[model samples]
Target: MKDKFEEAKPILTTLMAAGHQAFFVGGAVRDYLLGRESGDVDIATSARPEQVQALFQKVIPVGIEHGTVMVRHCGESYEVTTFRVEGEYSDFRHPDHVSFTSSIEEDLSRRDFTINAIAMDVEGGIVDPYHGQQDLRQQVLNTVRDASQRFLEDPLRMMRAARFVSQLGFRLSPNTKEALTTSRELLKEIAVERIAVEMEKLIAGRYVQEGVELLVESGLVHELPIFRNRNNLVPVLESVTSRPLQDMASFLSLLVHYSTIDVKTFMTEWKLSKATKNKAHTLLDGLERLSCDPLPYVLYRVGEELLDSFRELMDSVGYDQLHPKTSVGKLFKELPIKSRADLAVDGKDIKELFPDEKPGPWIQNLLNDIEYHVLLGQLQNDRNTIREWVIEWNPHDPS
Candidate 1:
């Protein structure tokens, strides 16, 4: 958004007034050129990290060693980094060392891709050193330099390359594609967490099928954790053409549905958060039950919060046919209760009904039956009605 640039313009002007060259750079500039809404603005300046910190009142030395600091100006944060060149990448992740430079061209040259190498000055002047704009015009992704050398420096770029295909709906240059295939094995050197971040974006991108096909064709899928050595599952992933995955949970649910891998294994291998794993498991449960369970029961099981995610997952995997005649939203709307907290009676009330029995699983079991009946419209949710109904209720013989 231009508002973001407007908020960040003062930072550029400040650095420039201090006799340093500063410009709007990276993804924001790239997105601006493509007429897409950009996220946070990143600034590349000839000012050193210390100079940046000195120029700003509320500066955070988040990655000062890497020549980056968070400049809080006008109630907005921008990543202001010194123009620098990186040395060899021994670990295939971070550069062995970084040295500040005065030339934006040298700094841009170290970028991963040409599309991300363009820069825009504070007054809207363009710096097209690498012809990144031309590459963007062609809708092709190319490494800043030699593809193999750039990949060797950081194998994560290969994943980023594939991710860009999905995000921008762009094709990979011939040389870039060939280098990605030859250097696919180098992905093992990359951390799974980093790979997972890129993979999530790729799966959720607009051109997701193109990204997945790149992984399969380049043999890069073999280097990944769950999909590794599972060439047969390519068709399963490629089958996701109807829509992009909603999130990591949906992606995992789709893959686990077709693969022999369990949800836990997928979660652990992908290094996903516990919450994501739980959601994926819930989605899988909903999918299985949707096939055989009644609509009300499914709505009760999935709850309103997951109703949308459930529908999206079902649609992504072509399981929408399971309830062709029923509307999931309408079913949810017609439900008497959405969750246990919405119940008119609590465990205490159920416990009081059976004074002779100790508080145990029966309380929950009875509540479950009550919830089921209430959802089926056989019992009213009114507290007094339920209180009277419990007197004649028999969990053992409800019929």
Candidate 2:
């Protein structure tokens, strides 16, 4: 499949054909130069948002005041933003006022980083006003114009700086690095949710250790939600191996494992989703159980759906050393039943086997016993075999 830029070329072509200057700007242009897969193709143009809406049949005024609209074309949506300059960042998140400009160069100046300040036209020409291409060549990440001013405008840029280190494996310029130390406290003004986004991406990047080091050195970690008080736990982030984590859930699991913090508190402080919280809980629980329980039993508890993620969590936390001879995958495959649902007999079936016994927690307990035996391959999953086994077993007898 063609990349996002190629797919959205017609939109650029159409905008230019309307006698307006337009170019593929921001991360899309940066990633294109880096030879990486860019996520979204954003168009920066001299045409105002109204002009853009007028030209495109399918236009969505998602952020019109900010000079942005979603242009639907060829089954893909591209954010077409007008070239503009901001007034003041009183909130440090959004610009207080914006004035549309015809110059892409002026618009590029307002961007956060030098690498993202470059622009590309439809015919593949670059507009590098601040020598972004040079920075890209040097593999150095720095802010546009003044580092302090740019960061003051938006503190999250500091987090993004460390994140870019992990993503691009680049070193921060001395000036940029110094600015991060001085302006790290501004990160407190940013929402935890936004900070969480960058933190997650930073840990998930290939150079996670480098990113964590930046976080520690820059003092940005001290500004984060939980890491602010737990300075000792911050270095623990460097313990993660070279292999990047699959996602935020794995990193959260790693944090909980090392710090032994309550999963619910972590979830609430970080403002994570319910699904993520539950996954972290499962991974943590699996690690605890794997230490004592048999491989098959632990696999059953972790469940098949989360087996791979659980294994990733295990590797991230260095739990793999405990099971040097064990192959979770191999053992899981050899199990007679993967889950309780796969058991031949249900609670109703077990209750029927013992009609005189009152229907209570005993049925679930008996199923657990059967499920364990079935998972260990000691008992067949066949219905008749399990029924006969249940008949011979005495639930009331301790023996």
Candidate 3:
């Protein structure tokens, strides 16, 4: 993991050369110690935001007010935030204000968790003022300070705690777990979008079932709109917990199925896009119709993308265990027409054949009819076969 930081080490070296303290901080350090692949490296520096910007050639002040800047180094962009202690969190989301600090301990003290508060200097020196490495070794997540106070500063920390259970495959310390249960109400103060982000990560995690159990046990599930009024969420949570979902749509598909609400309505409440709602709808339809496999019609109707999701969803529900089939994917691969685009003769070809008739609803209906026959193998997809079949079926001379 230390070798992985070679790309961003120059940023640390640059800050150090300028006589400002800088170190690899947060998840990057935690993940490095755990021997996991870290996403992005965050550098905490004693240099103020403006001073940090001056040192970088291409600097974007993405979150200057919060002491963060996007520094582009060697064709890679890195997020660099100044070491600071946050003021009171009035909204239970963001810090009302931040006070910059030179002491690393002061800056790390304000962090959410012990594992996340650990920092690594470029010379391979670790600054663990919060004993984060010990927590990582124990495979437990604990707050930097009092659990209740840490969660009170930002209620989203509660959801993040659950997400960490799935991501790091770690359990919360007893004190942290109690604080999460007590601070569950603070989650309602958080916006749905923030919870949605953490929920998505939580559901997609390696230990997703455990994460969701934490969410449910901690009463955080009650804060979500989709699960607020619902009771007996454990069965639904247990169903999907056994297997990993491929994407947010698949996860939402499993969740929405156990509910009385429609997929569109529930997804809309979570602030999901129209596209995601539509995809989940497609997956639900496929799940009901799949007899542990797809037929030719199902292949043509469900298409390729939904078929993969349906298979994953089926696994989540343990569908294949009862009605196992051989070579289900082979059926889709062998389909003659996956979509209208695969047809040998399209609407343009139909228009040319029916030159005397103006384009109208007939064109679309005719295309659909042609595709059905092509997929069913009743008619060959060759241009001449389709043209003759079209003329014969319609029995109209469009001279």
User: Best lDDT goes to which candidate?
Assistant: 1
- Please identify model 1 stretches exceeding 4 Å from their true place: 319-330, 393-399
C-alpha RMSD by candidate, in order? 2.1, 2.0, 3.1
Better of 1 and 3 by lDDT: 1
**Candidate 2 on 1-399: residue-level lDDT in tens?**
236777888888888899999999989889889998887888999999989999989999999999999999987888999999999999999999999999999999999999999999887899999999999999999899999999999999999999999999999999999999999999989999999999889987888888888988888889987777987876666675356887677877777777767777778888989989888888778888866777788888888888888878777666678666767788888788877778888989988877777788878888888888888778899999989888787444433
* TM-score of candidate 3 versus the correct structure, residues matched by position: 0.90
Worst 10 residues of 3 by lDDT: 290-299
Candidate 2 clashes between residue pairs 3 or more apart in a chain or in different chains: none
- All candidates: TM-score: 0.94, 0.94, 0.90
Please give, for residues 1-399, the per-residue lDDT of candidate 3 as tens digits: 365588899999999999999988888888889988887888999999999988989999999999999999878889999999988999997899999999888999999999999989997799998899999999999999899998998999999999899877899999999999988988888898888888778877888888878887888888876778776655676677665576778887787776556776777778887888888878877666666433576556777877777777767767668768834588778888777778898788889987888888788888888887877788898999999998888644434
Q: Which stretches of candidate 3 lie over 4 Å from their true place?
A: 1-3, 232-234, 291-296, 305-308, 322-333, 348-366, 376-378, 389-399
The 10-residue segment with the lowest total lDDT in model 1: 390-399
Candidate 2, overall lDDT?
0.86
Clashes of each: 0, 0, 0
TM-score, candidate 2, is 0.94
